[model samples]
Target: MHPPRANRAYRNVARVLRPVLYAITRRDWRGTEHLPVGSGFIAAGNHMTNVDPITFAHYLYDNGVAPKILAKSSLFSVPVLGWVLRTSGQIPVHRNTSQAGDSLRAAEQALAAGECVAVFPEGTLTRDPDLWPMVAKTGVARLALTTRVPVVPIAQWGPQLLLGRYAKVFKPIPPKRVTVVAGPPVDLADLYGRPLDAATLREATARVMAAITALLADVRGETPPERPYDMRRGGGGAGADGPAAPTADGAA
Candidate 1:
């Protein structure tokens, strides 16, 4: 199915931010060949810095896909920026609230409508001091399993260099080098048609995180730890984890 056409509000925002990003960040984007054109799919990326959404969106926009991002609820209340985000078809996530599920429902609807939905499964910036992707929420897995759409694993490096994690200072002077790589859709066929229990969700989320970590490893040229960092436990290893290799074409 063909995704919905890009709205003018998004185009206008892109027009304004694209040149700024182009002027400041030296992009080393790869894996555009894995993006599913003309169809709805989830782009699950690692969360590094606050500026990541901008760079991630820029990459998608330049690739001819205007993403419907699942952004934090607070961002939606930030004066004029909120209005622009709402008008541009961005979904607001109300974390740790009764309304948290609202974003997931909205994301499902966006997928059904054939709109590309970008998600940061980690939900927040990595607590892993090294900026490696930490254990992520299971929302991306739930969305992929329920919607049965491709969940393309995307890893981004260097946004934290431009603007440090949770830091307010923006350093655009040196023109930081940002690398964004998109791996093929994760293979979840074995997990599909199964019950959506906690075990199932964890397995699926693990796969998503593993694929993202591998891509980031390739970009950074370093082997990842045996396990992803589990934020709940405040640690550096979630053993029993393995890489989720991409599936054959047309297999979700």
Candidate 2:
């Protein structure tokens, strides 16, 4: 069953914190009603700024759902933040091979328990100068297929403008207008009986990314540049230095 008590508490905290976060960031959310009311689903979004997750969590909390994000394991190393995150039951993801299985297992257990989880399919922040979303990783698709959970695509804008890429050092710019938009959940029941092969997984993932891109376009009211977001000539050259690359249609 869903963690109703925990979710309720999360919502209460969100109601109190969102206003404060908005006061600092000046965020404006739209289309949040598109999110479903309960658990057993995955809410996925584009990863741009580091603050994107917090923005999403706060919004979800305001809308009556406490979202548990799949954060990088390294974040758990922080002193106080780590303690709060662990006690709150946030999922820790190990991107490296050594702990990937353990992370996946943890996610599976969470899903089986009827909890809602958020994932940034892009894996990491976009390094492209324009900040268009890059190709997404397949982990989200694999998780959805494994757990048979519906996937909800969310589009967020404005956080990058306030925090920019240097939010770590610089104070966040104030009174920035941030927008959060949620799309209808993408159903994968059609593939229930089919083999979960690479092609199928990619197809599903692409659809999810497309939904997010469309929502982003709506919020920005402009078409994104068509060039690849990752412009590095070779792989690994796109180390966290530049803006994120543009994604091919459904390339994520």
TM-scores for all candidates: the values are: 0.89, 0.80
Residue 191, model 2, lDDT: 69
* RMSD (CA, angstroms), candidate 1: 5.8
Query: On a 0 to 100 scale, what is the lDDT of residue 42 in model 1?
Result: 94
The sequence of per-residue lDDT tens digits that candidate 1 reaches over residues 1-252 is 112477777777766767888999999889999999778899989988877777887788778788888887777776655775777878876655777677778878888988888888776787887888888777677788999999999999988888898787889988989889999999999999899877788799889999999999999999887767877678875622211111110001
User: With candidate 1 superimposed using the best TM-score fit, by how many Å does residue 16's alpha carbon deviate from the native?
Assistant: 0.7
Candidate 2 similarity to native, TM-score: 0.80
Pick the TM-score winner: 1
Q: In candidate 2, what are the lDDT values of residues 1-252, reduced to their tens digit?
A: 222536544544555555767676765767777766655678888877766767777666666666677877766675544554565667776554466566567767777777777788777786656666665666777788888887888888887775565466434555667788888888777866778776777666677777888888888888865543653442222212211111111111
**In candidate 2, how many Å is residue 156 off?**
0.8
Q: For model 1, state the Cα shift of residue 11 in Å.
A: 0.7
Clashing pairs in 1: none
